[model samples]
Target: MPKHLNNQSSSVSLTVAAMGVVYGDIGTSPLYALRECFHESHGLPVTPDNVLGILSMIVWSLVLVVTVKYLLFVMKADNEGEGGMLALLALSQQSRPVDLRKGLNVVVTLGLIGVAFLYSDGIITPAISVLSAVEGLTLTTDVFTPYILPLTVALVALLFMIQRRGSGTIGSIFGPIMLLWFVTMALLGLHSLIQTPEVLRAANPLYAIQFLIRHAGVGILVLGSVFLVLTGA
Candidate 1:
């Protein structure tokens, strides 16, 4: 192959691999997020207006939180090609004046708390993703329903075991799996959009603002569920 062609192929391959390892949890959030938004506990009625409102929130949340916040801003703040809470902590300490650095014990405490949150999220995200995926089997038939919990537990345990081999190994194993998942889901979403093209109206920011204003109490609770979409980000 020509060198240019080879380089393009390599770029595409790396993008696919990154999509899996970095984005698998976010991809899987759809399995449960919409359901959680209208779950009985939230007392949200499943009307057309409500559906549009909730979807609008989801659309803007992805836009603002992931696209605008992470991709645009946060990703630009990396230290020496590294990112994450600890790296940011180190960067802050280095940039502060000696006199100001002494007052940064509070910053260190906050950074540690953020690290704990990230660690907790990593453990929780996979479990929820696996459990939600297994629960989808109930839609087809009840046969798998009885075993969902056991299967979820087994799958999560397997994931934990696989992690011991290092992230590179995990990425190599799961990258193609998640790439296939994303492609399958994209196709399904395209088909659904074809059927209900009107749903695209939910892309309007006004719908989200209206949703929160009209249903402030429930909307506040729903915001918690909406954040699920940001899990792997």
Candidate 2:
């Protein structure tokens, strides 16, 4: 291939890979995050105000934590060309003051703990994402309801089996699928927005503030739930 075409192809591949691997968790989060906010345990009433408030919280969390914090700040912390908890830990050890060298154990421990959390999330996230999607079949027909667990298990197992093929292969396979899923969701959301344009009012920060003030204790719980928006992003 020509040089410019090669560069374009590489860029496109990276973009697709990011959409598949990075966005997948965050994409599936909407499946259960909003529902969790209004679960019976939360005692959250599904009034229009409450709905708008929750939406506002989710929107802001994504903007601040994912967009601003991760994209702008965290992305800058890469060690050389590498990233992730281990890479940062290595970078920190190299850059630390001589006086702080004695505390290396503590730093290493903290980094290891962060790695453990990532591992746990890796295990839990895939299972939950697949199961939640499979369970949606229940809403369409009762026939699939009974087999939901089995189907989820089989699908998840297939995912793990494919893992041996490596990230590049997985990305090439999953990228277009996730891309289509996101595009479909965007269209659906746009259709809904066209019908209820007032929902856009949730974009204001005041609704989130008002929600916290009115709900008080419950608002804190909902805030934790809203943090789910940052899962994959």
- List, residue by residue over 1-233, the lDDT tens digit for candidate 1: 99999999988877777776788788889888898898899998899888999899999999998889988998998889999998988887796633554565677779889999999998888888899989999998999988999999999999889889886777778889998988899999999999999899999989989999989988999988988887877
Candidate 2: regions farther than 4 A off: 97-109
Q: Which portions of model 1 show Cα errors greater than 4 Å?
A: 1-9, 97-104
TM-score of each: 0.91, 0.89
Task: Estimate the Cα RMSD of every predicted model relative to the unseen true structure.
Answer: 2.4, 2.5
Q: Model 1: which residue pairs collide?
A: none
Kindly list the per-residue Cα lDDT of model 2 for residues 1-233, writing each as its tens digit. 99999999999989998888778789879987888799898998899999999999999999998889888998999999899998998898796633554655777889989999889878877887888789888887899988999999999999999989998888888888899999999999999999999999999999999999999998999998887666776
